[model samples]
Target chain A: MSWADTILQGVLLGGLYALFAAGLSLVFGIMRLVNLAHGDLIVLAAYLILVLVSGLGLHPFLAVLIAMPLMFGIGWLLQAYVLNRTLGPDILPPLLVTFGLSVVLQNGLLQAYSADSRRIPSGSLETASVALGPFNVGVMPMLTFASAVAVILILNRVLYGTELGRAFRATSDDAVTAGLMGIRPNRTFAVATGIAMAIVAIAAVFLGTRANFDPTIGPARLIYAFEAVIMGGLGSLWGTLAGGVVLGVAQTIGGAVNPEWQILAGHIAFVLVLLVRPRGFFPRAVD
Target chain B: MHGRTIPWRVETRTKASTVFAVLAAMIIVVGVVAPAYLPRATLQDLFFILTMLVLAQSWNLLAGYAGLVSVGQQAFVGLGAYAMFAGVVLLKLDPLVAILLGGAAAALLAIPAGFFAFRLQGAYFAIGTWVVAEIVRLLIAQWKTLGGGTGTSLPGAATRAMFGTDLVQRLMGVRPAQAVDIICYWLALLLAVATIFTVYRLLRSRHGLALASVRDNQEAARAVGIDARRLKAMVYLTSAALTGLVGALIYVQKARISPDAAFSVIDWTAYVIFIVVIGGIGTIEGPIVGVLIFFALQKLLADFGSLYLLALGLIGIVIMLFAPQGLWGLFASRTGIQLLPVRRLLRGGSLDT
Candidate 1:
């Protein structure tokens, strides 16, 4: 029974990891550009929410609603102006530019908010839990899990059902060919990043409510997100969730064995997954 | 036989060698003279620049030549540092010898790290290297003797008894601390010069051509009978060893070792990448120029705190966007200058010439 409870908690934890990875996977799927500043961007969104909450005296959830559009605009402009120019035959420029952006974002935040960790103060929502037969689960985790599912579902729907999604898929398939067919690869990429940023904002709300965060935390968060993405395989959102669950379960079980093993176990699991499936469990057929 | 003229001779020599010899003589003079005349603090700052130059050169060899942009170089840096600590504390080895062993240890670690990281391509490769570094950090953190996560300092006795310190003190007629600083500064200078010259020589060799071909196109290089993977792995290990040595030297000077400080991506990897990008990724002279620019910027704006990093990032982004080839590239385009002259020169005049 105890083991079952631990595993249940682990699965819930996976939801957060999934949310962290979804935006990363989306941008990669469309543009093949890995934003090294992604985790910092998420933190940026969280801080934006924090400011809205504290400055406007608004509820954290309501604050998230307002911050989403702002984050979308930031993401769009960032991709259009900064990242687009970095795209080329060589992979170094994009990675280097994003790394620079990561440094900038982290230090900018430090200048603005200092190095102190902050929490969103979710109040009763933080403590509320429900009995699920043998295991008691936190309401926040449940809500996080639900939101993750909703986000993935909505994303999948948009990706498969919309004309914009077609543009994204076409661009991903072959940007030059898509360009010839009248699709603006740059615009598609910008929109994809913008949409991904909105998802990052959603992930930020859950992340801030769960624990304290500071500027330095971004890289660690990026590691976990990257692990989930790699474990699931590139260009597949559902696989990312599954990967997160595997990571979450491994970490919890490792913690159960020895507390120091928790983080290490997740990393080990990622390596093990890579060893077994070099291209990940469900690699995209294209690349 | 000696008098017979060769019809087609590959002219490997260039006027750059003359320039290099002059520069080399100057460097030796400065290395010998600076310790006696310069202040201890100034020597220390020179040590910083020299060590950073070594790091930038190693990174350039890997990313610029081999096309492996590893953001996890801190892995080797930390491993080399801890290995030095372990060698000194556990094996009771001389600190100088332990520094060499640290380089070996990091090179050994690179074998498995390269195996795993080699599987991923492009951005995935970058993150893969970082994951491997994180794994190394976690494993090292579990070692209790190293103070686990908090880390431990080099024993006073171990530091005081470092080889050549007494010799340095007697020769320089300075205090023990100043003598130690002088020795480290000289060693750093030697390593920096050696690293740059070695890379310069390597780039002029046949293997350099193979590496350049591989960087341009992997399949084409492979089709030309070049063992691309082996060459890449060799470069990776070589750079790892050099970086490891530099890491050990750095820790030795400080007489301290910590997991966080040793394995700092921000300090080791990010800063080095910034240097490489802003200088020129694929050129020998780029790091020299980059390091000077970086040092100047750091000295001027370090007091501004986070603004310094912001400026670095902003400048890096601007350079990448507008001037991807970096300062060296910009300079070279305007005035076709090749400092090291790795490019092959045709001995005989072409038909047009």
Candidate 2:
């Protein structure tokens, strides 16, 4: 493959990872809470979308739209009711609880869906692609990438240009002090999780369309999102994109060398990045 | 011995010893009797449950006792499985012997890993453990002897031979892998007891006190000159070794070794975490009890399918919201209980109040 092909494939795959990492980065950036269930929620969203598409005969995109608001509500309730209780001086509680939550979600999904994988019903538009220079990219991947960029841009604008963003940053900076300013930290966290879930819903659209999915697949997505977040540094949205791009390129090149090398290459890159920069390549000093 | 200056001391060792003996008695009785009521397959499943209990207890040592919530414990589990397979395939070692080697391999792998992973704090630390798991999984997937991406299965007949019966006879029940399975059950039980005893001992020791102080308040611990990071690193390595051993046991019982199964983050890490939380973190009895409850719940809800998922998920949501200390906390609150002998309790005499 030419350099253009490598970069193009890399950028396209970055979209998938960005989709994977967006919800994770958003939650981490806004509140210092690391939702270990983030990837499972993505899997949950995929399941929800599957139900919507199958039960309602809606287009896959439309299924995503239907799932987004519902997921937002679930996320909101999860944060406000469950996660709020776990947040405190000791980080162990939330971590332990989320670890539990990951279990329940996956098993619950397994119990409901069995281990069988189901994919979102997408039309031929999935394969539809446009040529960018000499490289051809899937329309879905392109859209997924574009959606990632859009999500980040909108998040950045919201963070820097809106009240909730201010609240988000304020809470992130210091929840105690933010309380002094009359920001309801609990509510802010709820809204943050809600918004994060909405993004997750979008990611699920791409995830389901790209590959077959089951309840068991969430942890794998969690791995990718986690790597992207760590690679990009916490709280840097653009860094997530870069992390995704790097991961995508590494995987594609690894696959090019040998199909078996695909997953291995991504992990090697992650380890190398961690060794070279413990906090990540583009860590936020603010965090 | 006379001391110029005496330090404050708390004593409950007397009561702890009694309770420890009682729990041991109860476990032995259950192990001996439960097999009678359980079907052969069910008995085998019970062995698996025991394996998980061991896993959860080991994880509790790292997260509950050491305050390092690792999400990548699956790494050690996978490493152990791979090590056992290597022993079986290349060294042609007996399955039982492979388990000890597996534990050693997991511990050896975890040392350097602990150096990098322990550099992180809180959530970062959790993710760091996960990253290590990913690295391990991916690394194994590349090696040929390990069965790379597709994953290799252990020789079926060889695995069956561990039970002291030929494969056909074992399956047909002309010879029960009965002794073998029971022995495995016994081994897992013994290990669980030993792991709990070790952790409890650590908690009661002077070093245990320092670790407890670190878990409770790091700044105060630091001001007193405790090296929190090094202590945590040690705990992480120890937990890794214990979990690795359990993973080897699980593989031996299953008669299979596959990357997807051996390295399953969900199987070892997430569920063990759930067990720790739902039972109680920082308590030896919690994970054991939690695994029992969870396994029971799974059995009860096995028929519900996805709806069961919704129920389990809802249960998790409720646990996080209302019972952060988990089921064990409720029991402790009612009984002033400290099971598994980690902490000592004093019984009240008549008219004490």
Candidate 3:
């Protein structure tokens, strides 16, 4: 394909990555808790969607809608019961706990699903395409890109335009002070994680439909999401989308040069971005 | 009352430490002579334990002491193994010498890695290190000479002719394969003992105080004129070197090298993290206790496949939640005993009396 076409494809692929990163960025921004199992959670959501589609004979879109609330509940319970206990001055506990959770989730998925790669069968939508300017783009990619935009827009609204957003900001800024203000930091954190998981469900719809996924693919996705968050700068939602595009472009260009260099190129781009702009492209004022 | 002198001395060694020291020496003696009486299978298991102990100790020093909290240690392990492979395959060096080269290479890798990682803090630093490791693994996989993504094995001839294999064969009256295992086992034991002793000594030194201070509160440590960054870098480099050496030794034992196996976060970092966390993160005895328990668990859960890892993860989470200090920490607190005491006690003071 032409260079423009490749770049366009990369930008579309980035939507998927941004979708992957949105939940992680949200959690990290709100609580400074890096959920290591984030990628697995996305995969878990994808599997949930898969079961809904394959087992329950629901449409892929409908499956995601059902999965979102269920995922939100899981995230809520996980934060309230497991994760909140790990938060403290010591960084080791939260990190180790999350890392352990990542392992458990991956292994659990493996035991449940075997090692087989699964993809949500989206039928003709998977093959349908739309012409944009001189290039043809898959309808699914366009939808994914649109959904990513929608997710970020909605999250931004949730984070900025809502009363809960104020509480989130307050708790993020100073949990102790926020607690003193009767903001209920723990409950706010639960809501925030729940929302993040809900985003994971949306991301899962695109992820499961777009490509093949298996149990062990989570860490790589986590890395991609992490790279996007780092590149976008912490706490900047729009910047995450930009970071994902950059990474996606890098991978596509690298793949054009050599298929093997695709993933490596994205990682190299992240490291380079880190070298030049360690705080990322759009760092928050306080952080 | 004329010219009365204060009668007190600061001491790090305690009665328990003294007894533990004797016990440690006895264990070392037994370990050194184990190959003669033990079967090859048992020797291999001992080798695994020794190498893992070294890894756990290195990680503990980095995370528990220096507060680096890296999740990318597989970078050092993988690089160390690859460097050793290059040495043996291309440079025609003895595997023993290549092991040192591996350590050097890993330490070298740590310099740039530290530069990048130190820019991030806490949890971000952990992810940064992991990214560096992923980058390294990806790059190493592209090195076509090393069999690329598929990985390569040490030539049987080279392994057979490895410097001390013949001597081990003669001394132990075993086949060349068994001899290689014995040599690697001895090397692993030596490295483990060296790692533990070095860590113990370092903790007893002034640097140990600096490390503790940095971990507890970096700002206060800096206010006191401690170069927190420099101290952390030193710990990082040392941990990388030691872990790299252990990695090289491990690959040498396996006689084969694969990128996935070598660079595995689960095998190298996650397991080591679990071991350190389970044993007691900051204490010297924690990894020792942790490795034994880990080994026992592995033996018991060996047949369960994914369940083994799932169990380990669950156990790790439980420990982090309920016993953050680990089993050793819990024991130490309850008993008020430190077998390898690094805490200075102002003993025999008039105030104490």
Best by lDDT: 3
State model 3's lDDT: 0.93
> Candidate 2: DockQ?
0.47
**Order of quality (lDDT):** 3, 1, 2
Candidate with top TM-score is 3
> Candidate 1, which segments miss by more than 4 Å at Cα?
B1-9, B350-353
- Stretches of model 3 off by over 4 angstroms after superposition: B1-5
Worst ten in a row by lDDT for model 2 chain B? B344-353
Candidate 1 C-alpha lDDT tens digits along B1-353: 23544355466556766687688788788787898899998899999999999999999999998989899999999999899999999998988899899899999999999999998878888999999999999999999988999998888787667788898888878887777788888889888988998898888889999999999889999998999999999999999999999999999898887888999998899999999999998998899999999999999999998999999999999998899889998998898777777777666433222
The residue-by-residue lDDT of candidate 3 on B41-111, one tens digit each, is: 99999999999999999999998898889999999999999999999999999999999999999999999
- The DockQ of predicted model 3 stands at 0.89
Candidate 2 residue-wise lDDT, B231-309, digit = tens: 8878888888998888888777766667777787767776677777778777777887798888888789878765654
In model 2, which runs have C-alpha deviations exceeding 4 angstroms? A47-67, A107-116, A121-124, A285-287, B1-9, B14-46, B146-176, B303-313, B339-353
Can you list the residue pairs that collide in candidate 1? none
**Model 3 lDDT per residue over A77-122, tens place:** 9999999999878888899999999999999999999999999999
| Every model's TM-score on chain B | 0.95, 0.86, 0.97
Which CAPRI quality tier does the interface of model 2 achieve? acceptable
Docking class of 3: high
